[model samples]
Structure formats: C-alpha cells, structure tokens
Target: MQRYFIAPEQFGQHTVTITGEDAHHLLKVMRMKAGDEIMVCDGLGRSVLARLTSLEAKSAEADIIAEMETNGEPMWKVTVAQSLPKGDKLETVIQKCTEIGAAAFVPFQSERSIVQYDGKKEEKRQQRWAKIAKEAAEQAHRSIIPEVSQVMSWKQLLLRMAEFDLVLFCYEKEGAAEGSGIADVLAAFRNTHDSSREAAILLVVGPEGGFTVHEADEALAGGARLAGLGPRILRTETAAMVGLTCLMYESKEMGGA
Candidate 1:
C-alpha cells in the first residue's frame, strides 16, 4: 500500500487531510481519487488505513479506518553522533542510517573533522538532511522519522551524550586492544541495564581523519565506551552504521529471539 505522512493537525478524530505537494501527487501523479485506500502515518507510531473521501486542488481528505503501531521501529532509541566528513558524506550517512533504524543523528565537528559548519550552510544542510531522513524512513516503512540535529561543538555533543544510558565510540585502536571490542562492551551493557527502566544508546563515529588522541580521551572520560569495530578500519560514513547494526543485533532488537 502507498503510504503518506500527515501532520498532527491534519490527523483529526477520524480523518486525514493531505495537503500541498502530497495532495497534488495523489490527485495528479498517482491519479488517486475518492474511494482510494491508502496508508497514513503521523511518523510517531500512529499508522492507519484511510480511504480517500474528497480531492481538492490543494488537499485531499480521507476517512481513517484502522490504526496500529508499526513494527519497523527499534525497541530503544539509537542516536548516532557523527563527526563531519568531507563532501556529501554526511547526507549518505543520514540516508542509510535512517533506513537501518537509527532513531536520531547528530553531526559534530571534531579537531580532525574535514568539514566546517558555517551558520548559513549548517541551516541548509540540516534541512537537506531532514528531508533525506524523512524520505528514507518512508521508503523503509518506518513509523518514526529520524531527526537530524544541528551541527554541534565538542562540548554540546558531550552534553547530549549525558542523556543516553550508554554511549559507544567506534575506536580503531581499541580493536587491537584486549577486551574492548564492541560486542564485549555491548554485552556487558545489556546485562547491566535496568529492565525496570528505559534506555537509549548513543553511537559516536569519528571523521575521515578520525578522532585525535585528546578527543578520544575526552569521550572516554565522558563515559562513552570506545568499542572497536573490527580488525579492519571502516570509513567515517561506514563506522556508525556498522556500530549501530552490531548494537541492535546484540540487544536482540534486530530479529533475535
């Protein structure tokens, strides 16, 4: 079924009003008419079946049928804090990571990061990232859209890190070090999590040049686990996705019984 994301206000008691470009797509492009059935979601887990009842020049109204939670979301939130990479690497990161079920993203600038964020560029980039995330979520049939946060400074990144129950950093050096692999740390973290309470995981990945010694040390000091990906080094864009995949797998959120 084709799915459309509707705003909160558009989702009234038992109706959905899809407006603007979306309405145009349905009416003109898709040639949908009254009595056409479609799936609609608020991107907050409220997914429902709706039957189109009216089509206008700028909007389409539908009657809500059934509402249910989408199973595509992870059991817990997983936010990736990625150091800015050069070119359109960040866009690719947002796009793929969202498809893989990342709950949110934070693009930060570290000492060795190749990309610098100016105010104007940052605003435009955030919007672009947000759009990418939304499209990826819709394509993946995800009920919730991942948020792409503002470009953060080192201190700002740490402040957000404080909110997560556990944080993991993709540390290449740690791969060769004894007992510091991602699986090891994640296993321990899962064992210790309070089942009575909720938890969030923050996965951090360095840029193309990787995190400098001081930066890595700061993260370690801030209670972020420096878990190694593997023996081979991963690119800046690949590390976070790999880390997230490992984490979700270990946590039994990725198809484990």
Candidate 2:
C-alpha cells in the first residue's frame, strides 16, 4: 500500500489531513480520489490505515480506520555522524541510511573534510538533507523520519556522541591487525546486550581524505572505539552506509532489530 508521512498534528480526531506538497502529490500526481485507501504515518512511529474522504486543491482529508502499532522501528537506535563530503554524497547517505534504519544523520566538519559549510550554506544543506530523509522514509515505509542535523565541528560531534551508549568510529587508519574491528565491536555488543539497558549505537565516518591522526586519537580518547571497516578504504559516503547497514544486521541478530 502507498504510504505518506504526515505531521502529528495532521492526525486529528479520527482523521488524517495531508497539506502542503503532500496534498499536491496525492491529488494531482497520484490522482487519488475520494474513497481511495492509503497509509499515513505520523512521522513519530505511529501509522494508520486511512481512506481518502475528500480531495481539495489546498488539502486532502482521509478517515483513519485504525492506528497501526510502531512495529517498524529497530530495537537499536543508530545515529550516523558522517564527515561532510563533496558534491551530493550527503543526500545519498541520508536517503540510503534512512532506509537502513539510521535514527539520525549528523554532518560534521572534520580535519580532512574538503567541503566546508558555514552559516547559510550549512542551513541550506540541512534543509536539503531533511527533505531527502523524509522522502526516503515514505519510500521505505518507515514510521519515523530520521533527522538531519545542522553541520557541526568535530569537537561538537564528539560531545554529541556522549549521549549514545556506544560510539564507534570507522578509522581507515586502523589496520587489519587492529585489536578491535567492526566485527569485534558487533560481537561485544551482542554478547553484552541487555534489554534493561537502553543502548544506542553511534557510527562515525570520515571524509574522502579520511580523518587526520589527531582526529582519530581524539575520538578514541573521547570513548569511541576505533574500528576498521576491513582493510579496504571506503569513500566517505560509502563508509557511512556500510557502518549503518552492519549495525542493522547486527542489531537484528542480537534481537534488537
């Protein structure tokens, strides 16, 4: 069934109203008419089976049949802190990672980052990424839309990592012989996971040029384990997706999916 993400407010008393661009898409693009059935998600993990009751130029209203439980959200919350890359890599990462169950995307400026976002540029990028995440959530049938935060500095990113139960940094500089690899990290979590303990995973990926030695050291010192994504070097965007996908699979295997 087709799904659309709506604001929590749009979910009124037994009715789901879609306005703005979504209304246009349903009325004009999708050519949906009255009595057509569709799924509506509140973008907060609440979904509903709804049928179109009225279609107007400014809005579309649907009568909600039932509230679907929040079953799609993964048991583990995975946040991706990716260093700003060049071109449209950020957009791609946001869309793909959302589909893969990333809870949030944090764009940070690293020491080796090539792209710099200051002031207005940062705000514009955040807006674009958020839009991509929302569309991706709808496409993937996700109940919650992963957020794309404003670009921050490496230090700021590190501070934010403190909020998560486990912070993992994908260090390209980490050799294969490194004591703790990505697999090892996953194993450790799986072996020690507790339902009573609210745990969250934070994956950090560097830019195309990768992180500077000092940056990697800082992350490690800040309590993030430096794990290798194998010996092969991955591009900035690719590494982020890799880390997130692995987290989802591992979380699922550990009953956190």
TM-score versus the correct structure, for each prediction: 0.94, 0.95
Q: For candidate 1, lDDT tens digit of each residue in 164-192?
A: 99999788999878789998998898789
- For candidate 2, the lDDT comes to 0.86
The TM-score measured for candidate 2 stands at 0.95
TM-score of structure candidate 1: 0.94
lDDT of 2 by residue, 1-257 (tens): 88999889888998989998899999898999999999999888889999999998789999999887767778788889988889899889999999888888888999888887778676677778888999999888889999888788998998887788889999876648656678888788778789555468889998989888899889888989888888888888889888888887777633544
Q: All models: lDDT?
A: 0.86, 0.86
Number of clashing residue pairs, candidate 2: 0
Clashes of each: 0, 0
